[model samples]
Target: MLLVKILKFNSALLTFLLFTSPIQANEFWGLESWMNSLKTPDFTKIKDVNQRKQAFFEYLLPEINKQNEKIVQLRHALKTDNINSFKLQKIYNRYRVKEGDIDTLLMRVDIIPASLILAQGAYESNWGRSRFAKYYHNFFGLWCFEKGCGIVPLKRDKAATHEVAKFSSLDKSVEYYMRSINRNSAYATLRKIRKNKRDKQAHITGLALAEGLENYAEIGYEYVETVQSIIRYNKLSQYDYKS
Candidate 1:
């Protein structure tokens, strides 16, 4: 297992480096444009669910792999007690993680399946047409309680003061979304669910993962159901093959 993991980490590092290389790096508006430019069709106008899922998943798969690759690298780092790698250490520092906190690091570094991510993005961003999605490129409906950490909802309830998180680009939003779920205590159950699926080599179902995100919205259960509905209606289960 250790040898296999090391080989996988090496390959992943090479691929990650290639993807980030200036020649290969796409210089687009990022996560938003990455999806918006898929098939060069306006994302909002795609009325066919299957076709929509195709365009979206084709774009999302590479990103999910990239995140999981990072997790693999982190796992390798801990297993080998290698903490000084620049890229891995930077990612750890960005997540406010300590070098030796393996469990916390694992939870923070793992991947959320593309199926669940796509389903949540579709629901939260209104098929990429919401104001947060359009203006802020925030596809995840993430909120920031700090005044400057996010944008204030114009019609926000006076009693509620949380602001919707904003991102400079779509990729940043996606990165933060994964980090938020992986690191936040609220999503521990969700992480555990994904971890269990990995351990058992079982296919991850967006419906099951939705159980872990009950705290994602004020409406709670309604939000989970809505996400599950989107996943089922779009056949997103086809994309949850990550193992």
Candidate 2:
């Protein structure tokens, strides 16, 4: 009788594993498929400036929209339901918020506008023709501190220890970019601007938030102006309407 019980338990466990493993595999394959969708194109070969800009937008906008949709879902989850402590802690860690600081987590997990993402990507990667964008898939100029973690900047300061971060896919780069914008101290002003807009129930335009990005480049306000100029020039605000 004891032997028969043990055999039945083993059989049940085997059956459970057989049933669950394909679902796990399919989840992984689905993620792989999503990553595969964000293919990079050789923007440098496009001779016309207008054509290059259009191509760049077309390449990035879909991935950007997907990322924003994810954030919206996460934000909704946090607002509407009680998530498990482990999952809530993961959100806090991802946004660098203090544990139990639900308010800050909510603030930091919001979506960045697609227009702002496009403008920043266009400027930083030179419409995807930059060496870092081509080789490393690093569009937002993020840095990693560990050695061998990323590509060393050719023009890095002699004492600087940071290297530009590399990504396996453009969508991952966009994910990190949005997270950085949400959590990094340098972009606190931008967050505040976004929060205020949210409070007022106003349209969150890329042009409005660009005002807070004074520290994004060494030129301060000039950088903000340049980003706003790009948004205006390309009619990027049109994308922000749905953001």
Candidate 3:
């Protein structure tokens, strides 16, 4: 009886591994070279508004997909019992969760839907034409506090210490933006919405998650409404999971 149960457990583990490995492998296959060759296009040079918007989205989609793919891989790793202890510890530290607390790590390590990312990027950066976006690759309007850390806002009060955060590349900006959304207390509601959607097997739409971002801007709920409006007007939902 013991031998039979052991064989069954082994078979189930093998089946699980077989089912998941291919999907994760395909997500990463051939992506590194393509990502390496990518360059940020000069969206500011496009005169037509429609053409510029199209160019901006095109430039951003691949990097967004790449970042989401990495998040998905991390989530998958966390679900397995045999995950490397070193890698798991790194994930816990990176997400600022207690070590061995897989539930919180899972919530913090998940993907931000492409639609939300795109809408926020467009709304914040004026469709990639803002000085921060053009000069610093900071499409999400992230701020940094250390002196000389980033560009100071022209309109910032003399007493204000925060400066708009700069990034070495658009990818870095997206990475930090996603990390902020996942780990920040301000977006705890957003993470809850995402986790609820996952539990229900629902398509995690940007419009739905946008509701949790009322505090993202000083304008409160108005900011959430504007983000949702951007998603609707631009049809950014098409980039998100359909089912």
Candidate 4:
């Protein structure tokens, strides 16, 4: 009887391990681990423009989906006024990227790295601490002059000091950000590059997208360089993939 009991205990332990091992493996990899597996492009070594473009788009899609889902959940939590949910959702919404707009942008232009975009949003909004970001859901630091759309900041400047835009909710803010990039003439170069990538069935690269936003910063050309530096130094673009 004692021998039989020992055999039964061993069988149960083996069954438990069998059921739990796969789950453990999946959890071990996680999202960050999967993202790290993507091949990093050595700009110096990769001379083929077409190949580079293709790689950029492929890498960007998964990251875009991840950020978009977070924004969606965050918007839902805010609308419901669930404070606990809001706290959790805030992390995702803090660096939002619109899904539909990204798809449209990619369809019309080349792919942009989702991580780079999110990093820019985080920086612009000061990690969601900026007045516009906290009160208006303006995650991208976009300024609006028109009435009925945004609020005017207390401090006014010649360029955009008084011109802060507001949103009714997080979704609207994300929508506006997408529209700003897609419709604005300044981003036309970006749109065109996207179109070319789509035509050739290629991926988007953060390096390429940086070129289109030559005017994104107050510092002119230097702003573009800064974003690139952030992406490279921190390896931010590596997050633009799935696990």
lDDT of each: 0.72, 0.82, 0.83, 0.54
TM-score result, candidate 4: 0.51
Which pairs of residues collide in model 2?
none
Error (Å) of candidate 3 at residue 95 is 0.5
**Which residue window of length 10 is worst by lDDT in model 4?**
31-40
Model 2 spans > 4 angstroms off: 1-38, 241-243
TM-scores of all models? 0.72, 0.82, 0.82, 0.51
Which is the winner by lDDT between candidate 1 and candidate 3?
3
Candidate 2 overall Cα lDDT vs. reference? 0.82
lDDT of 2 by residue, 93-171 (tens): 8899999887888889887888888898999888988878876788887789999778898989999999998776787
TM-score of candidate 1 relative to the true fold: 0.72
Residue 155, candidate 3: Cα error in Å is 1.5
Give the Å error, residue 146, model 1.
Answer: 2.4
Query: In candidate 4, what are the lDDT values of residues 136-184, reduced to their tens digit?
Result: 5565778765764456766666575346775544545555565466556
Residues 87-161, candidate 3, lDDT per residue (tens digit)?
A: 778878888999978888888988888899999999999998898887678899899999877889999998999
Q: Model 1 over residues 64-134: C-alpha lDDT tens digits? A: 66775776777677668777677667767766678657666766666677778889988787676677776
Q: Could you tell me how far off, in angstroms, the CA of residue 3 lies in candidate 3 after the best superposition?
A: 65
Error of 3 at 107 (Å): 0.8
